[model samples]
Each structure stands twice: as structure tokens, then as C-alpha cells.
Target: MSHAPHSPLPVGHYAYDEVDRTFLKQRVAQFRDQVERRISGALTEEEFKPLRLMNGLYLQLHAYMLRVAIPYGILNSGQMRALAQIAQRYDRDYGHFTTRQNIQFNWIRLEDTPDILALLAHADMHAIQTSGNCIRNVTADQFAGAAADEVLDPRVHAEILRQWSTLHPEFTFLPRKFKIAISGSPQDRVAARFHDIGLMARNGENGRPVFEVYVGGGLGRTPIVGVKLRDDLPEEDLIAYLEAILRVYNEFGRRDNIYKARIKILVQALGVDEFRDRVNAEFVAMDRARYRLDEGIVAAIRARFGVPDFDPAGQAAEKLAQQRKADRAFDFWVRTNTHAHKQPGYVSVTISCKPAGGIPGDVTSSQMNLLADLADQLSFGELRITHLQNVVLGHVRQDKLYGLWQTLEQNGLGTANVGFITDIVACPGLDYCALANARSIPIAQKLSERFASPDLQREIGPMRLNISGCINACGHHHAGHIGILGVDKRGEEAFQITLGGAADQDTVSIGQIIGAAMSEDETVDAIARIIDTYLARRTAGEQFIETCRRLGTAPFKDAAYATA
Candidate 1:
């Protein structure tokens, strides 16, 4: 049988044979038994909590949230179709895709979760690592193997990590949740710099794949960018380096306070150079035999992630562009949402999960089915979930873009505002989180309406507006070009604004707050005022960050505080 363009299981990874299949078979049976016990009162909530959470079941504000893992962010149309069915049949008619590359059905019943897991397992997917403090779904660039600027597909490395970290005895119970992100491109769209471990693929002087490693970065009450430990370690040293870092973190990272228990806190307290030295020392003393990379193993892993079957025809993009002249809306989508692919005749199209006033990453069941069908029709049955909280129908031919956009528009999935201000990233705040002080979704929704125009977004020129309900920066507000942090001021919900924040390859500076906090209503208006000020003050062709830096924060700071 011919392989699909983007195979979910890459070549180098272990294939599901009789033995592996039997393990899954037994695991499903075991979970089914656990569910029956819990339902029949043989298991209490406390007893079933850990077991269910391990299988990606969480009781949230409204209902049980079933988180299904998309390991390393790879998915096929059929799996997505199953997800659509799950949402339509059992959930709240929609599912939310999180930054961790997992989808959550927010309205699942406690008794229905096992059936959901079984359904997912049938599709060669599962919800493992969806919760608990163990290593979560390892994420990489959504573009992955298809990015034009990528040096190497980081999914290869991500898959390796996924295999090694799965149910590992040593790192399972860590100080806190651990996140790892990889970027094969220098563009850093995946925001690797803000993760627990950020691995960037680069070529050494020998032109071989080497990794630039960053450690101790995280968000929430304290936001810090990772510090580089090794600039050019060969691919073979990945396991050794990662093991060394994890050992140090597991041993010395804070455990007394859950709030300050992340590796970032330990790294910050110890200092970067000291941390690096500690990691290096641990690496030197470690047993190399247990973790060293085997070329054959790496080769097999590489084969699984092999590129999709794509024709070398060069005229697709041009032909698509020509068709756009006849359809203006399709042309808008082509210009704004379609990204360049390494392969000619193909482009990566972002299926915006953001609809006016809707949640940023929420997709309806019908939308999912349409997307799955659309992916199969246009892109050889492959799709990717982006960290920005959207979907990508990769490998779309230029010629079929118009029809796809028409379909997307009919399904409420078509929004030409890919990088627009309305396309916001927000955390599930007071509504669902135990730690939140304010609501983030309303803030995002209000801000989206405030600057809802595509023309204004274009004029603003690539601005990122991120909001977090509390100090835990799950929304990644610290990295936004214009970051808004929600705080509690005298028991009232208030917001603080920051400038010059970024989460890219060149810089990862945490945004500096300009002044005192404001009420939720005023907060939305204040963001508008800030953007208005930017429009008035920026020099010709200056981006948001450049204008903030060139004119100094005093101007924007004063503008922000003027209403304080």
C-alpha cells in the first residue's frame, strides 16, 4: 500500500505489531474495568481521579474535559473525523485545541470517557500524557517537515523524545509540569524559547544537524526565557544532554512549593552559568551506554517522518494566484492565510479556529468533519494543529484554494484574519481554572471586537495580543507583542499592560508593564488607546516593537497611565 503524505507513525519509530497491539488491547480492557468500578461506586472520586486523569479525564467547571493527545502534533483526516464524531456525539458539540497540541472536549460525562478513549485508540491515537505532572505531549512547529525555512524537521527529534519519555520510571513525578518544544527553523513560530526545554535545530560548521539547547524557561507568576546551555551539540548527543538536564532539575528543582517548583525557578535561583555547569557535570558523570543514540535507530525514526508524496509540478501556486483574480474573498485568504511551502505547487493554509466573539481555539463538530473532508480532498488527508491554537491543512494546491475557502466560509471556519488582532490567544481563566483571579476569554473577546478590522490589523503590522487570567501565563501573554496580564487589585479584576514583549528567535524579552491596572471594560478600551497611540507615534514602516523601542516606553507608558 502507498503511504499517505504525512504518516502519523514515522519510519524510525516502532510499528504496532502483534505484541504492541496486544499491549494496547490489554490497556483498553484495564481502563474499561476501572471505569465500571468507578461508576458502580466500587471506586471513589479520589480513587478514580488519578487513574482517570492518567487517561486524560478531568472534571472541569462545567463538565468532564476529555483531552486527547496528538503526539508531536501529527494527525490524519480520519483521526480528525473521529474527533469530530466524539465531539458531536458526546461532547458540547465542539472541542478546544490547546497550546499543548491536545484537543479537549469540555462537556464529557464521567461515564462516557472510557468509550471516548476506546474510540481514540481505534484511530491509532490516545489521551496518554494529556494530564498528570509527567511529560506532556511533546510539541514542535506545526509546519514541521513542510516549512520552507526549516533546516530539519524537528518532529524527528520530538518523536524520539516522545518514545523515551513515555512512562519512563525516572522523570514521571517531577517538581511540576514539564513542556518541551522544538523548532527546525530559525523563525521560531513554535515559541521554543518559552518552554521547559527549547531545542532549535541548526547546522554546525560541519553542516550536520546540531541542536542549540535552552533550559529553565516557563510562564505563570514568573515568566522567564530559557538560557542556552550548548550551542552546537551533535544530534547523537540529544539524549545525553536532555537526560543530564532532567536529572539536575528532578534532583534540585524546588519541591516544597508547588507554585515555585518548575525548573525555571531553580535555574533562575542558581543562575544560568551555574545551571549550565551543573548540567555539564551531570552529563560527564552519566552512564553513556543507556542513553547514547544509535545511528540505525535514528535512521529508522527519520524514515517514519519522511516527506509526503508530492508532485514536483511548479505552476500550482501561480495557477492558484490566477484563479484568485476571479474570486476576491478567496484571494484574500490566499494572501493572508496561505503560507509558502518548501514544495512548489503547494502552500500551507491555516484554518482559523477564531470566529467573531468565539473562543480562539474552539472548533465545532461539523467544522471538524468539513476540515477532515477538506484535508483529504485538497492536501492528501493530512492536517496539523498549530500552537497558536489553530489548524493547518498542509499541502493545499493553489488551484483548489477558492473552493476550500468557500467551504470554510460556509462552515464558519473561514476567517481571513489569520494574523489580525481578533485572532487572539487566551487561557481558560476563572471559568475553568482553579488558580485564575480574572476571566481571560472575555478579555480576548472584547479585545477582538475592539480592533476587529483587517485594515487596522494590517496597519498595526504583525502585532501579537495575548492575555492571561492570572500570573500563570498559560495564555503566553508575556511573549505577546502587546501583552496584557490580568491581576487582582484590591479584590477587583484589573489588567496590566506591557510593551516590547516577544517570543521569537531573535528576542524573547518579557513585556514590561507600563502602569497601574484597570477594570475589564477599561482594559479593552485601553488596548485600543495603546494601538491608537502606536499609530500616531510610529515612524514610517516601523513595527510595534520597533516603535516601542525607538520612541521609548515613556510615550506608550504615559499613554497607558494617562487613563490610570
Candidate 2:
């Protein structure tokens, strides 16, 4: 079948040229043959493993999981519907959104892989560079173009990196997997500091986008914050600076140990000064024009993501106050789930995927379909996937929020917890991932159930909780306000807790270990006790992290181990 897009796509997404379409079509055809070869035993499993992985297919504990890159987590309605269709037709009726802003179908079949790729291609999407030891997805702020405090929209830069890194010949097989996250806003919504290369966009003297480059930050076995390499690198030098960093890492990064393969290890060994010097030297020696990101090219790409024609008077706000007074639930939902938008009379609505008893970040096909419709109707035909594993309708009129929330509530999509305690971030753990030593989903589920009360969650206030099944830190436990790391103890799962970690740009930090490992039940109980202690000790308007900061982890630690 022709792999070309069967229908014209929505205009809100980053525009792809004819070359991109051709590349995707060719890749699908190549992978279709590879799948056929593997099935017929013409290729050994080991031989086919790399090929399958390069296409973003993985063999998990239960079934094959396909990780599809929503490049920078921006999705148009057509792309959203295509994902829903894939979930319904090729795999199970559900898909899971991951921390890196990719979507994974945990039940994809080997035989149906190519057809799924074909379906994705039909919507101008593909799964390339979603996996592998190469530079993975270039994640950016979900509210890049919409946030009120944004200094420079990171979407253009993110798209630049996306194009530059795809199948990059020199860096395809690095010492280990790499991640790069960029944020346009000063708020750092994308957790830029915890990524391999965190690019924080700022305005230059001339008021164009410059970057504050951070190198060697990652959260795995050795969780480390990236050190600032450049405070004010110009926009044209962005690509060149990144290339220099990668070249330095490619040469000096360790290959002897998988545990020490990340650039963080190299940076730690060399010290920040030495690493910075090497990267700068490399940058100076390289042919400058070969890697210069031209302004014309940048502008051309930015135009592809055309500006939204927001209504001057979005016919908004006049009815919102009345609706909030009419329905208390709507008010609560609005308080947490809605965010400030740059445009007047509009807001970005965060649709929480973490229901009281449901798995965090998992969405049903029906829900995806409805969200696609909602995106088309209320959010200007575009949707965004947040790093916290929630969906954002980034451009909704304030007047439409009540009706949108009502529709979401009827469909079980309105969980009313955006960043609350119940909105947990968790890896699939032993239930899905083969590398997991423990289960993260069940723990998250129990915690969500325990703190299921919206009233209780609101009382607790803005909290960041994360769980990792292993030290890989895919769930980013190290950067959470309250972090839980699951490990293998003697023959069973044991979880350890950490407190006072933060992920935002203002107060980014790694959590400190609170105590030794405990059973899943003990872990849940410990969390409850910690929360109870905070409730008793906190002053009015004190958030959880604020309480932890003022009193340190001593009281919370004592409370956690009181039962032991």
C-alpha cells in the first residue's frame, strides 16, 4: 500500500516537507520487509532486534511495545485520531503517554507492526528516533508558544534539533541513549535540568532567542544536574555548540561500562571546567558555516507552525464566573487543571489522565477520539502532551472550559487532579518493562486510591511525586518532590523514598534519600504517615515542598519509619 498520507493533515502541527514524507514512506516499506523476514525465520531474532528497535519497536515483558515520537509532544487532531485508530485496530484499545512525551502501545503485534507504521504515515507521523542509543526525542515545553512567561518560543529550536538529530550519522551509536529537553519559558515546565542536554531559551540583547546551555544532566543510576556550559550562546550558534558537546562526549564518554556510559559520568570524571574547555575547543576547531543554523531557515520552519487566529474577545470569561459559582467541582478543576496563557481571554486546559484508580498516563481509544474532537472544536485543532504525562488543550476559550470540563467528566477524562498527589508519575515496571526489578503501577495506583479525595489533594497542594521500577529513573524519581525508587531486595520488591527534590527551573534539585527500602504496603503507609505529619506541622498556605524545606526531612523521616 502507498505509505503517503491518505488525507490532508490539520495545519496546526509543524509542517513537514515532501522530503520528510518520502523518508517516512521509505522507512515504512523497509520495516515492512524486515518484519516479514523476521516472521519467516529468514532473519534471526538477534539480527532483527536492532532493525526493530531502530523503528521504535521493543519486546517488553508481555508483548511488543511501539514507542511513537510525537516530536516535541505537539499533536494535531488528525495525528491524534490516527493514534486512536492505531490503538483500536492494531493493538489494545489503550495507549500510554510516557515522561519523554512519546506514546507507547504495550500490546502491539509483530505481524501488525508495518500496518501500524503505514497508518501513522497516513497522518504524516512516524516512529523514527523514538528509541536507540542515539539522540532521542527533543522534548520541549508543552506550553512553549502559549505560556505567559515564555521568553522565546522553543518550538522552532526543538524542531531544528529534531530535524538535525534524526539519523545523524556520527552520533547514531553513542556511548548510551541521550535525551535533550528545551524550554522557552523561564518556568522550565519541561524539566530541562534533568535531561542530557538542557537548553533554556532566553532573549539576546537584540531580543532574539539565545540559549543557556546545560550539559551532562540526567536521572538514571547516577542522577546529576547538568552544569551550565554556556550562559548566552547566540541562536545561530545553537546547532554548532550542540555538535561540539556531542563530539566531545562521543570521543571521551565511556563505553566500557553501561552504567557509566552517560555524558554525566564523563563530565563528572573530567570536572565541569575541563569538559567545558574541551567542548569549547571543539566548537572553535569545527568548520563554522557547516553547522550554522541560519535565520532564514529558522524563520521558514517557524512559519510552518502558523500563529493561531485567537478571537480578540474569545467570547470568554463573562460566563466563567457564573459557572464556577454554579458548580464547585468545576471551580476546583479549573484551579488545578487550567494554566495561564499568553493570549488574553484564553487558557491552556490540562486534562488529567490520572483518575482515582486508573494507571497514570494511560488513555483509551475512545478517550483519544473524544480528545481529538475536542482539540478540533475547542483547542484550535491542536493538542499537547505534557512532560508530567498529562494532555493539554493549549488554546481554549475561557467560555468553552465549562462545557469542555462537563464533557470530559462524562467520559471519565476529567480527573480534576493535574499536579496533585493523585496525579502520579510512574514507569510500567515489572508489569511491562523487562528491566524492572519491582512494580511501579500498582504502587502508584494504591497511592492514588489512598489520596483519591480531591479535597485532601487540594489541602496538600502542588506536589511532584514520581516512581521508578529500577535505577534507570525513567519515571524521574530523582527529581520528584517526593521520590520513590523500587529495587530488588533479597528476593522481593523493596521501595525507598526520597524527599525535598524539585524539577522546576526556579528550585531544581535531586531528592535526598529518607530511609531504607520497605515493602510496597510499607511504602504506601510511609507516604501516608509523611503526609499526615506535614498536615500537622505546616502553616497556612505552606505547600508540601515548602514544609519539607522549612523543617527539612527529619520529622517526615521519623514519621515514615515510626511504623517500622
Candidate 3:
């Protein structure tokens, strides 16, 4: 069957040129042939496995899984609608949004993936490099262009990196999977410091956009915060500098042991200074002009991301105030789920996918359609998927928020608990994943149900609670303020708790294990006890992390290990 070309350009973001379209079409055709060969027994399972994985097809516990890359987490209404259609037509009528800012269809058939990929190509999307030992999807701040405090739009740079890393010959089959994240704002919602490489935008001496580069930060069996490789790097040299770092890692990273294959382990073994020196030496030997980025290319990419038509003098404060006065729930949602926008009278809206007793990031096909409609009506036909497994409508007018919230509430999408305890991050553990040691959704559900009260969550203040089913740390448990890692002990599910971890831009830290493992039932009580201890010992205005720091883990340890 011939694969016909769809639209050459994406709906709202950067338009894909002919080269991009040709690449995706050719990739799909090649994978289709691979699938046919595997099914026909011309290729062995061992041989086909790597090819399938390289194309984002996975053999799960029951069936095959397909992960579609949402580059930079940016999505338009057309793309969202296409995803909804895929969920409805191909698999179950739901898709799980992952912490890596991608979506996974758990029940995808091996025979259906090529067709699914063909559908995605129509939206200028793909699944390339989403799996296997290659550079995965490049993630960035969901609020990249819209945030009020952003120094620059990180998506421009993120898109550049995505193009550079796509099917890169040297790094395609690395020691292990690599991840990179970029953030434009000082407040890092993307958790950049927990990736293999992190880039934060900053203003240089000449007021041009520079980057604060960090290397060797990752989470899995070993969790480490990245060290600053350079305080300031010129924008033109970004690709070359990154090439240097990846080259050093590709050369020296451990290949014998799977667990020690990550770049973080190498950085730790060699020391950050030594690693930096090697990268600098390699960079010095390279031809700078050959790798240097042209300003015109940057300008062309920037042009594709057209500015939103915002009303500068629009008056919406009075309407918002009146709505807040009339409805307390609306007021609470506005306070928790909405954020300041770069444009006046506009705000970014975070729609909490995690409801009480619900799975963390699973959104139904109906909800997806609703989101697409809402995006078209209120959010400039654009939306973003966050690394925290939440959906964001980045350019909603303040006056339209109440109506949007009302519709969301009617459809069970408005939970009014962004950044709250109920807003938990979880992975598809034993329920769907083959790699999981235990179930994570149940634990997340229990926690959300226990802390269902908005008043209680607000009183407790901003806290991050992450759950991982195994040591792979897909849920980012190590970076959470309260990290819960599920493990298999003698074929029984047990949980280990860690405290004082953070993934913030200003204070990135890894949580320390508090004590022995607890049963799932006991784990819930332990968390309650820890929270009670924090409440009892906290000073005025102290958050959970601050209270923990002031009183230390001794108090929490005692509380957690008490009679229960």
C-alpha cells in the first residue's frame, strides 16, 4: 500500500517541511516491512525486538504497546483530535499521559502500529526514538512561550535539539537511553535537573539568549542531580557543546553493565571536573564553523511559532472578581490551577487529570475531544502536556476561565487540585507494565482519597508526592518531596519511603530512604504519620520540605515507625 502525504504543516506550531514529511513516511514504510518480516518468520524474535523497540513498539505483559512522541509536549487541536480518534478506533478508548510528556496506548496490536503511525504522520507526529537506547523525546517547559517569568521561549531551542538528535548516527545506539530537558522559566516545571542533560535559558552579556548547561543528571537505579557544565554558553555554540558532551559520554560510558550504563554513573566515576575537561578537549579539536548554528535557521524556526493574537487592553479582572465572589469552588480552582501569563488578561490553565480515586494521567477519548474543543474555543487552538502528567491550556483569557471551569466540572475534568497532594504523579505499574515490581495506581488512589479535602491540601501547602513501581523511576519518585518506591519482597508488594527530595530549579535534591519497607496498607499509614509529624512540628509559613529540613528525618522516622 502506498502511503500518501497528508498536510505538510502542523496546525499551530512549527510546520514540517518536505524533508520532515519524507523522513516520517520512509520510516513508517521501513517499519511496516520489518513487522511483515517478523510475522512471516523471516526475522527472529530477537532480531525483530530491537527494530520494534527502535520504532516505539513494545511487547508488554499482555500485548503490544505503542508510545507516540509529542515533541516538546506541544499539541494542537487537530493533533489532539487525531489522538482521540486513535484511542477510539485502534485500542481502548483511553490513553495514558506519561511523565515524560508522551502518550501510550497500552493495548496496541502489533499489526496495527504501522497504520497508527501513518495516521500520526498526518498530524506531523511520529514515534521515532521514543524507545530503545537512543535519544528519546526532547521535553521542555510546558509553559515555554506563555509563562510570565520566562527569559526566552525554550521550545525554539528544544525543537532545534529535537531535529539535531533525531536518528543521529553517532548517538542512536548509545550505552543507554538518553533524555534531555530544557526550561525557559526560573521556576522549573519540567524537572530539567533530573534528566541526562538540562538547559535553562538566561540572558547573556549582550542580552542574547544563553544557556545554563547541566550534565549527568538522571533518575533510575541511581539518582543524581546534574552538575553545572557551564554557567553561560553562547546560543550559536549549543549544538557543538552538546555534541562534545554526548561524544565524551558515548566514548567512555559503561557498556559491560546495564545498570551502570547511564551517563550519570560515568560522571560520578570520573568526577564532574574531569568529565568537563574531556568534553572541552573534544570541543577544542572540532571544527567550530562546521558545527556552529546559523542565525537565519534559528530565525526561520522561530517564525514558524507565530505569536498569539492577544488583547492587550482587554478588561477581565472585574468579571473574574465577580465570579470568585459568587463561587468558592471556582475561586479555589482559579487559585490552584491557573498561572500568570506573559500577556495581560490571559492565564495558563492546568486541567487536573488526577481526580480522587482515579488514575493519575489517564484521559478518556471523550475528555480528549472535550479538551480539543476547549482549546479551539478558548486557548488559541493549542495545548501542552506537562512532565507532571497534566494538561495545560496555555493562553486562556481570564474572563473565559469561569465558563471553561464550568464546562470542565460538568465533564468531570475540573478537579481544582493542581500542585496539591491529590495531584499525584504515577506510572502504569503492574497493571500494565512488564517491568513493574508492584502496583502504583492503587497507592496513588489511596493517597488521593485520603487527602481529598482541598482545605487540608492547601493548609499542608505545596508538596510533591511521586510513586514508582520499580527502580527504573519512571514516576520520578526520587525527586519528589515524599517519594514512594514499590518493590517486590519475597513476591509480596512492599514500599520504601524517602523524604526531603526536590526537583526544583533552585534546590534540586535526591530523597533519602527513611526506614525499612512497609506493606501497602502500612505505607499509607506511614505517610499519614509523617504528615502528622510535619504538621505538629512545622513553624508558621513552613512547607513540608522546610519543616522536614528544620526538624530533620529523626522526627519523621519516629512517627513512621511508631505503633502502626
Tens-digit lDDT string for candidate 2 (479-529): 888999999999999999999888884877899999899999999999999
Give every collision pair in model 2.
none
> Which candidate number maximizes lDDT?
2
How many backbone collisions does model 2 have? 0
lDDT of 1 by residue, 1-564 (tens): 122355555221224446555666677778889999998999999999989888888887777888888877778778889999899999878888888878888889877877887787777778877888788888888877788998888877888898889887898888888999998876787788788999899878998878889888887778888888888988888998898999999999888999889999999899999999999999999887788788887887777654566766567667776788877767777788888888877788998888777788888888888887787777777788988889997777666777778888888888888876777888787777667788888888877777766667678877778888888787888888788888889998888887878887396788888888889888777778788899998889888888887887788877766775
Q: Provide the lowest-lDDT 10-residue window in model 1.
A: 8-17
Candidate 1 local distance difference test against the native: 0.81
lDDT measured at residue 77 in model 2 versus the true structure, 0 to 100: 85
Greater-lDDT candidate between 1 and 2:
2
Q: What local lDDT does model 3 show for residue 298? A: 83
Quote the positional error of residue 444 for candidate 1 in Å. Answer: 1.8
Q: At residue 157, give the lDDT of candidate 1.
A: 82
Name the runs in model 2 displaced over 4 angstroms. Answer: 1-11
